[model samples]
Target chain A: MTKQVVILGGGTGGTLGANRLRRELPDDVHLTVVDQDDSHVYQPGLLFVPFGLAHPEDIVRSRRRQLHSGIDYRQESIDHVDLETQTVHLADGSTLAYDLLIVATGAVLTPEETPGLDGPGWMEKVFTFYSPEGAAALEGALASFREGRLVVNVVDMPIKCPVAPLEFCFLADWYFRERKVRADIDLVYVTPLDGAFTKPVASQRLAGLLQEKDIELVTEFNTGEVDGEAGRLVGYDEREVPFDLGVVIPLHSGADYVGRSPGLGDDLNFVPVDEHTLQSKAAPNVFAIGDATNVPASKAGSVTHFEGEVLVENVKRFLAGEDLDASYDGHANCFIETGFHKALLIDFNYETEPLPGHFPASVGMPLLKESRMNHLGKLMFQWFYWHALLPGRDIPGIGADMPSAGKQTETAH
Target chain B: MPTRTIAGATVDVNDEGFFTEPEQWNEDIATELAAESGIDELTPDHWKVLEFMRSEYFEKGTGPTVRVLGKTSGVTVKELYQLFPKGPAKMAAKIAGIPKPRGCI
Candidate 1:
């Protein structure tokens, strides 16, 4: 009998896994993928949309077109997951069964989690770039603004690409400089953390960059509410930061269906998986990759790509009745766009902090240091993302293991 | 691999990803790093400590001093020494792949 494999969510992880598995599996195994819509937005590109560097049409493509021919693609909202039966229930009152399951249903931004955030000034003076619609709307708001307080607030931790908010501040500075109206605008970054990032060395570097750019950093400011009408963000301790324009990265949660499934996820609806194997703690046959897993790593596309390789290998190992290789390190690499034709690259895993040196080696791209080469690499990644990355092809030199080439190994005393 | 010098230290770039050999580290590595970079025998909370260290570096561009790492991780300076005998500067270089960070020694 042909094994039935059903994958959920047609985003980066799902799409790539579907295509690769379709090619890898014999004719006996059937592959099927389900997602709510056919549109697959280049999510990373959303950061550039608000700055008018890209058109909305350029960022979105049909998910169906991206998949290989033999795979079955379905368009419908996921209603619930029946773990006991190994089935997926659709919102349209239909169901499908799978011998093996992959949950790639990444995260959703919950603006409603905050009071007054989605209120009167939503998309007027306040906005978010997490969604395509939000990015388009923010473009207009940024274009018409002449001056005043512009605050970018991160409501909480575990948000997508934790450094993106800082990148936005850097790009905004460059954007205003280009328009010759930088001095007229005030930029401030507010986060719940005690520093600019989760890592200390990177945080110190980024904090200096923030200061150099004239952007204020408000640390440990847990958001209590967003008073959109008053153009202010109120902290849990009652400290208020007034703004003429606010861009908020709202609280993030996993797919709605995660909450419906018994013992599948946490309070945030993120699937609880063994931080190592990417295997769901609730079920042995089910696995998760990308933003969907409550893995203690940045929820970025690069992380998803890295996890997909490990998950796919383990899935194959599981089917063959062999010991699954519990070898997925929380490996993540991201290009931080610092604007003015400069960027920084950081490569890290769950245990190791992002170190400085050349990536892949000591002679290659500089790590934890800003350079124009990194900026170009960031721009060029869009092509690689669509062509090589999502197709589940091995990225030649970039493997699951973090390399130690470019680093200087000396014990500090 | 191309070599470049930034801030007076040499950095090697390996596009083909053959920078470090995994077998060098002992199989029985530290629990947290064993799963990722495979460094062993780490007793202190390196993740919590290094994450704070990276966050601070992101903001300021330099590794925090031993006193700062101690203050941030909520461990005493002596406690930090117990984890990283070489201190913050040496530990950071090993993790970040940079030359032993300057200015500390």
Candidate 2:
């Protein structure tokens, strides 16, 4: 009997998971990857689009091309999953019954959830760089603007690539400086978090960078309304931050199909999975990874990449009727792109916050310190992401667990 | 971690005064914590939000964000701001004896 394995959402997690499973699982196991569209976007590249650093066509490829030869790639909208029957129903009136289900449907931006956000000034003055179209549109908006306050507002938490907004601010400062209009523009970063970021040590360091770049940091701002026509972001607490142009990361939630499937997701439609195992709490046979899960990890590609190793291993264990591996330590590493050809790299997990030192080893990339080498690493990652990461090939030294070799534990305090 | 005496009971708290151990929390502690945030009194409406936060924190190991609470906690976002004042998620979680609602990143 062939074991049918259905991987939902052919984005970063699904593509990697399907490819890895094909290599690991025997010929007896059949793999099917489902997604609404055929485009597999290099999401991290979207950040550079508005700055005119990268083009749209360069970052996108066919989803089917990324999968292994034997794997099935289905381009159809997901209607819902019948968890009881272990089946996925497609919008095209078809069903996929699976022995194991992997929910890799990542988060989606919900701009309409906030009042007046998708209204009047949308794409004209208020723009988002999360989507390729939005990023392309913002490029025009950003290129034209030479003065006035440019507000980069994160509507709420759990957004994909949480550091991207801050990176945008840094890049904007550099871009405007290149144009010699940086001194004329007021840069403000509005976020719902109490600081510049979630983790303390990193937040302090990032807050310092923002200060050095003259970007105003507005903390604890839960956006209630975006009066785009009026050029104002009204907070739930009635605090208003006026802006001439707004770069907003709208509220994010999991895939819609997860919500339609009963008991599979949370209030935000993110699948509730065991933090360690990536096994869905709703059912033993169902698993999730990346931004789709309600796990307290950054909704970043790095986290998804780390999770793929553990997730594939667990799926194999589950199929063999063996104990699952709970070795996923929430390891996440990110390269923070600061302006002026310098970036900071930070590595941490569930138990420990990001600390300053070298990453992977003492001779590795410097952690939490700005360097030109880290910036180059960021630029080179687009190639690494498409060629290596999406194909499920391991990067040799990096693994599922965070390494503590060169991290300064004392400096974290 | 640090210890603070609130409402005549010694409880463990973090630097921001959020209860490190949620088991040490009680109604009296909640009352005193609420007062600290300038909510002179805890109304039935306030307790409604606080109770929801407590139950959610215990079940999920983290308090709900304001958006989640507003959508599912039987309280409107407008009412949440009215009840908890400046910051609904952080302020309510603090008074409700839970860790601060933090960004996942």
TM-score of chain A of 1: 0.98
Q: What DockQ does each prediction reach against the true complex?
A: 0.02, 0.73
| Cα TM-score per model | 0.79, 0.97
- Alpha-carbon lDDT, every model: 0.79, 0.92
- Output the worst ten-in-a-row residue range by lDDT, candidate 2 chain A: A404-413
Least lDDT summed over 10 consecutive residues: which range in candidate 1 chain B? B18-27
- Please list the residue runs of candidate 2 whose C-alpha ends up more than 4 Å from where it truly belongs after superposition: B102-104
Kindly report which residue stretches of model 1 are placed more than 4 angstroms away from their true locations once superposed: A408-413, B1-105
**DockQ leader:** 2
Cα lDDT of model 2 by residue, A214-268, tens digit? 9999998889999999999999889999999999999999989888999999999
Q: Write candidate 1's Cα lDDT for B1-105 as tens digits.
A: 565333344445344221132222221322432234344654446655655555555553445554345445576555555555443434543453323222220
| Lowest lDDT block of 10, candidate 1 chain A | A404-413
